[model samples]
Target chain A: MPYVKIELTREGVTREQKQILIKGITDLITETLNKDPHLTHIAIQEIDLDNWGYAGEQVSVLREKGITADKK
Target chain B: MPYVKIELTREGVTREQKQILIKGITDLITETLNKDPHLTHIAIQEIDLDNWGYAGEQVSVLREKGITADKK
Candidate 1:
């Protein structure tokens, strides 16, 4: 059983996006790792901005300073 | 870096319980795997019953059929 977990900031991601993520990950695992798509379990965790930290600062605080994790 | 993800049904789990889980898992990994607690990341995912599947059925369906996953 291949279990894949994706954690992201709770940035208003839709249910359809989550479905696509689950399906895409399952397909990738099946193709590369030879895992069964039916047995693959994928979970997406949408963490709160205050709960997620990076570089010793909370995401919420970083956002206040116009800093973000996105590469743009 | 050690990353641990815990997934459970969205069944009224409190924030305190999640804190406990994160701390406990970090300690366990530090002690057993010699991982640094500072480098350990723990995430808890609360999933909807209809989104989690087991045994060819969703958890919501299993609950309706009186087939609970909890071990007594």
Candidate 2:
């Protein structure tokens, strides 16, 4: 069984958005790995800005510095 | 930054159990990967028996057949 998890900032997520993501990711992984959807487990996770960091700084700090999604 | 996610069958789980798991996993990953707890993100997702499957059948179906946690 292939367990898939997606991580993103928990900013704005609607039930509809999550539903679409679940379906899309399931389709993508099943297609790529040739695995059955029944056996594929997908989990979506939302991360708080302060709890996640990159470039030796929290995501919140990076945002304060006007950093875009990409690394500076 | 490392993101860890744990997936288990949603049969019997308590808030205390999840709390313990999150801390233990966070510590393990931080120590093994040399990452900061502030930078490490952990998410736990529980799956329903019907939504999870194995051995070419739904987990619920397998349970009906008296299959153990391990494969037949």
Candidate 3:
């Protein structure tokens, strides 16, 4: 069994998106590792900007400065 | 900052329990990793028995068979 966790800023996330992410991650893991789909566990977590940081600066602060950009 | 994810079976979990878990994980990361509490991220996820497996058997099946047990 494999456990995976995906964490991102909580600006916008929908139930449908979460569903897709869970399925895609599961499929990727199963395909790559040859593990059973039912045995793969994927959890997606949205972190508030204030709780996420990069380079010793919180994401919220970087957002205010317009220096933190997400690619994709 | 470090991100920590805790995954476990979802049988009985309370909101209060989750709070304790979050705090404990964050504190541990902050202390051990020397990361700031405000920048540390901790997400706790509970997986359904049907989704988690061990030894090629789903946790639900093991539960039914009384072969899977959690310590503490």
Candidate 4:
């Protein structure tokens, strides 16, 4: 069994995005690792900014300081 | 660095339960794998039943047929 997990900050991701991610990942694993599509499980986790920490600071606090993942 | 991801069906898990799970898992990893707690990451994902599949059927459909994880 191949299992993949994706964690990202809660950013209003649509259901279609999640479905595409799952399908894409499943296909990648099947092609790259020769895994069965039916046995591949992908779970996407959306963590609230307040609950996610980076660089010793909460992501929510970082966002207040003009720091965000989308910023270049 | 140690990372753990737990996936469960959306069943109204309380915050306290998640906290306990995180703490317990952190302790287990530290004790067993000698990993630093600060570098450990734990994510709990609660997925909608329709998004999770089992036995070639969606979990929601299985639940409708009275097949559930907690029934055992």
Candidate 5:
């Protein structure tokens, strides 16, 4: 029942990568949060750079400014 | 962390309503998914009626069709 949603700028991630990311995150949730992996729900939103803003800047600009530079 | 994401058609829900929904969902997650409330992450996306679809119909139409009519 724990649902996780991720909103990010559209990128070159493939379906395989998406699956891996979700699995990894779900595994981490089970380990760190003591959650049941079977019941966890995850959703990812691929948003346009212009549509997602942070700190008064679009995600693209913020990435260039090193805001999300460390996040892979 | 167990992250929960909810995407729904935009409704006239207030901030208090939003908070209550989040809390209730989080509590359910804790009970059902065995997650810790402190580490659980929940995100809600409010989309226009035209943006969300289910079972070959928009959420609005689906609701009228009694698909999501039972979900409060």
Candidate 6:
């Protein structure tokens, strides 16, 4: 069984969107990875925009510069 | 970018194994998910065999019955 987890920082994600994400991920795992849906465990943790950073730059900083960090 | 994360419960995993897991996951995200390795963020949290449960059964219980949960 493959255990999948996600941590993301994004704005304007609703609960419905989260469900879609979960479904999409599950489908991807099953189709692309050839894993069993029931045996695959997945979890997603939402991080505030202010909480994520990369290359010494915060997500907000990147966004202000027109760089979008798309959630998968 | 798609954020990939993993949580696993297993025994006899060494530090080298953990590194391999990370590299494998990063490659999978880049190749299978078609995401940039730099943009794609991933994390793996190791859970003790006693800490994970499924279908009202612990990992140890399943393993004792000859059911192996393979790490992806």
Interface RMSDs of the predictions, in order, are 4.2, 6.3, 6.6, 3.9, 9.3, 6.9
Task: List residue ranges in candidate 4 displaced over 4 A.
Answer: B1-6, B11-45, B50-72
Docking class of 5: incorrect
- Give model 2's TM-score versus the native structure: 0.50
Candidate 6: misplaced stretches above 4 Å? A14-16, A30-36, A70-72, B9-38, B43-58, B66-72
Model 6 lDDT, full chain set: 0.65
Chain B of candidate 6 vs. true chain B, TM: 0.63
User: In model 2, what are the clashing residue pairs, if there are any?
Assistant: none
The sequence of per-residue lDDT tens digits that candidate 3 reaches over residues A1-72 is 887767778877765566666667777777888998767666555689999988999999998998856675
Give all candidates' CA lDDT scores: 0.75, 0.72, 0.73, 0.78, 0.67, 0.65
Q: Per-residue lDDT of B1-72 in model 1, one digit per residue for the tens?
A: 987777888878898998898888888899999987889998886897655544334556668889886789
> Which DockQ values do the candidates obtain, in the order shown?
0.12, 0.10, 0.10, 0.14, 0.05, 0.23
Model 5 alpha-carbon miss at residue B37, Å: 28
Model 5 chain B weakest lDDT span, ten residues long: B12-21
**lDDT (Cα, tens digit) per residue for candidate 2, span A1-72:** 776666877666654566566667777767888877777655556789999888789988888888868665
Stretches of candidate 3 exceeding 4 Å from the true structure: B1-12, B15-72
For model 6, how does the per-residue alpha-carbon lDDT over B1-72 read when each residue is reduced to its tens digit?
A: 457776656566567655665666566545543445778766666687678887788887888898774424
The local lDDT score (0 to 100) that residue A29 gets in candidate 4 is 79
TM-score, ranked from best to worst = 4, 1, 6, 3, 2, 5
Candidate 1 local lDDT, residue B41: 90
Predicted structure 1: lDDT: 0.75
Worst 10 residues of 1 chain B by lDDT: B50-59
Span of ten consecutive residues with least summed lDDT in model 1 chain A = A15-24
Residue B8 lDDT in candidate 4: 84
Q: Which residue pairs in candidate 1 collide?
A: none
- Candidate number achieving the greatest TM-score relative to the actual structure: 4
* CAPRI grade, predicted model 6: incorrect
Ignoring the other chain, what TM-score does chain B have in each prediction?
A: 0.86, 0.81, 0.83, 0.89, 0.64, 0.63
Q: Give the per-residue lDDT of model 4 (tens digit) for A1-72.
A: 976667889978876666667667777778988887778766666789999999899999999998868756
Clashes of each: 0, 0, 0, 0, 5, 1
Q: lDDT by residue for model 2 over B1-72, one digit each (tens)?
A: 888877877778899999999899989988888888999888887865654444334455567888758665
